[model samples]
Target chain A: MTGERTVGERTIGEQVVGEQVAGGGSGTDDFYGRLRAYEGRAAVAGGEGRDAVNEPMIRHWCEAMGDTNPAYPASAPPTMLQVWTMGGLSGHTGGSIRSEAYDELLALLDGAGCTSVVATDCEQEYLRPLRPGDRVTFDAVIESVSPRKTTKLGSGHFVTTRMDIRAGGELVGKHRFRILKYAPARRSSAAKERTTEVKEARRPRPVINRDNAGFWAGVAEHRLLIQRCTDCGTLRFPWLPGCGACGCLEWETVEASGAGTVFSYVVMHHPPFPAFDPPYAVGLIELAEGVRMISNITGVPYDKVRIGMPVELEFLRVDADLELPVFRGAVA
Target chain B: MTVRVGDELPPLRIPITRTLIVSGAIASRDYQDVHHDAEAAKEKGSPDIFMNILTTNGLVGRYITDHFGPHVRLQKVAIRLGAPNYPGDEMVLTGQVTAVTDGTAEVSVTGRNGIGNHVMGKVTLRLSLDFPHGEADSPQRGAR
Candidate 1:
């Protein structure tokens, strides 16, 4: 709570509890340790639907859902599988089908301070439609427990449960439900004021060793350099010490023409990463000297980067000490 | 990911929320107004914002890998959307193995929401190390 300050929704406090958790690392293992025990076990068993599918109830449900479709016959909506068993507005607080294990599980999570819960999603498959006045029976089992996930509300675990619904003792539908049980995160009051002192995220350091040092040194000088096998005239874009074709350790550097054409390209769009902007183009550029290398493509819309598009090499200053060779689209 | 006929992956349940639908749509780079804007969605014939296909695709990938571990790579996910998954609905995903080769498996998958089948599809998974040998050496199919 030290140095905590708050003005609005924003806040700045002390250092983050564990930054690794934000990066999806296993920093909150204890929270999940108590969760994994219930996986694949029966959460509720021998559950019987309170009411069989009937006409008046169907009309009520259809009216509530604003559904006006008429098919002459009465078939309950597949989504209504759970509706038949729900305690409804009054809520079914306790019952035989409600497993002690389920109660204990909620207690365990509550004990860990994750008292709030919100349903995240569900999936259902229907094998048969419910006719008027068909009794529904069901059973449910704990399916899986995900590790701690950071959501807007806070950090918590997602628990999934699966239910099998049957009509007249015949399998009809399967329902899977997931919920995030979490405690609301306490925002740091000092967070807004401390943001100015925050540094830029450091780029992942390149693995530089004796074999690749000189190539980076050349990049530092804004030169596009390629390695050539002295013995066989073989050229490679990636600066490898030895030639694969001739088994020669002796190699020399050659200054490239800094011109190339796109051989193949990919427009990344999903799963935004920290270090790079998505929907950007990355191209495998085949150089004029005939070796291909991958680099960031610039000066063209990510969608418009075509095969055989011309490009010219340019140096991009990535940070304080790192420079990278990037290719810019040449004017048509 | 290696599979034969009749293999079943464990079920995965998901509870739909405004945040889950919105974040999943964003992660998949889907910027449709209906996916994130509730008011816009209501105007466009939906009672509320619903989950998009890309989020369903990503969740399918998660379900497949969760069953097969991290080594199995999903090569293709072809799904057709059915009923919309509105917020406050629960989705259950189930899968059955249809075919298998040395290092690959093809699975038939279905994700069902409260209303009905949200997405039905076939997934092709390639297990990188299922065997020592890689895929077929030659592109040509030699006729007997």
Candidate 2:
């Protein structure tokens, strides 16, 4: 477990310290080789949880979550698998194993100016129930380091790690955590505006896949469309590849009659985005044809949106190039 | 509480606000920017910031366990995502007991967001053969 080791197509070192491994591509790839060296290596060991699974903490968590599951005091939420291992406000100072290779990889990134970090995504699998008095322990490994990727948050590498949570040496769950450590993306003044005009105009392009391509095409022509299973004659909204009723893969489109009612809706107020205005009514409209579709509700104030409110199909020209299907609130 | 097949669990209506999404993500130790930042989410081809699957999963777990009370042990939660739960929306969760055995039950749940069904799945839960919620926690009643 000393100097250089060869794994697959690349050569890595167990104790390479901070040696910058020259990469095969551009500046983005400059330090990838060095970062990738930490993969498959142990990053933390002998990590003891802050406290054993208990009722008080579970109650606190449940209260914060507004979860009234009467099962928590008797049994912990499977989703709280990682809470036991958290370092908390005390930080990762005690009862946890820290790996030199992992620290060095982070340091290398810090030195290269990709300092800001953000958690991207994680997947977890529960294997056993955690009850009160279960003393949790875990060990983590540097799972993988993705090559450089440029995102809206800037350019960086995605570092993923896997942790095994054990209770009394028996595996209870597994958590795969991924994070992006990178330099923040630069935004133009136009995008930094706080006015009503700019933020409402920068709508992100719709993601169109083969299954739903015709739906967007229909929108461009001022036609509200629904997918009808040719085999079963069943109607569906927001098109899908196959019919749920018959599993038929063939389908055809029928123009909507431009009628519907508000089945449900929500008004956004915080964590503002660059496109949609806050307190705007985004509704799930149950069309006259029986299939439901979601779109912005207009022709009424935000608070006026209500269930069973009449609405009609209309096209909204968000920007010079983007026209989306919207529903106009009709007279009561 | 004893549950029988066809027992309907009261639907839980959760407001799809940015705070709700962000708090849930952070509580779960998830730091993915897409869960919290909208502009960055747009860069990733999403309409706006959308709820992560984990949050939806956690909600599903809570939705079932909440109904079964605290004694039910979740054996498995298999779910598939359908639509995104964007902010400015509401998620209505509904569940029904699908099966019941000697000491366990199977419940099917569907959480519908504005876009469509945000998550749809089943939860296999285990508990004592017979018990009541108030009595189940009597052992730990005064530990507070």
After superposition, which runs of candidate 1 have C-alpha atoms over 4 Å from their true positions?
A1-31, A92-96, A187-332, B1-144
TM-score of chain A of 1: 0.47
Q: How good is model 2 by TM-score? A: 0.47
Model 1: per-residue lDDT, tens digit, A101-191?
7777888878877776645544555566677888888889988877666655466666878888898889987766666677656556434
Judged by lDDT, which candidate is best?
A: 2
Question: Can you give the lDDT of residue A154 in candidate 2?
Answer: 62
Per-residue alpha-carbon lDDT of candidate 2 for residues A102-191, written as tens digits (9 for 90 to 100): 888888888877887655444566788799999998999999897766655566777888889999999998877666787665556434
CA lDDT, candidate 2, residue A13: 16
Per-residue lDDT, model 2, residue A126, is 79
- DockQ, every prediction: 0.01, 0.08
What are the models' TM-scores? 0.37, 0.47
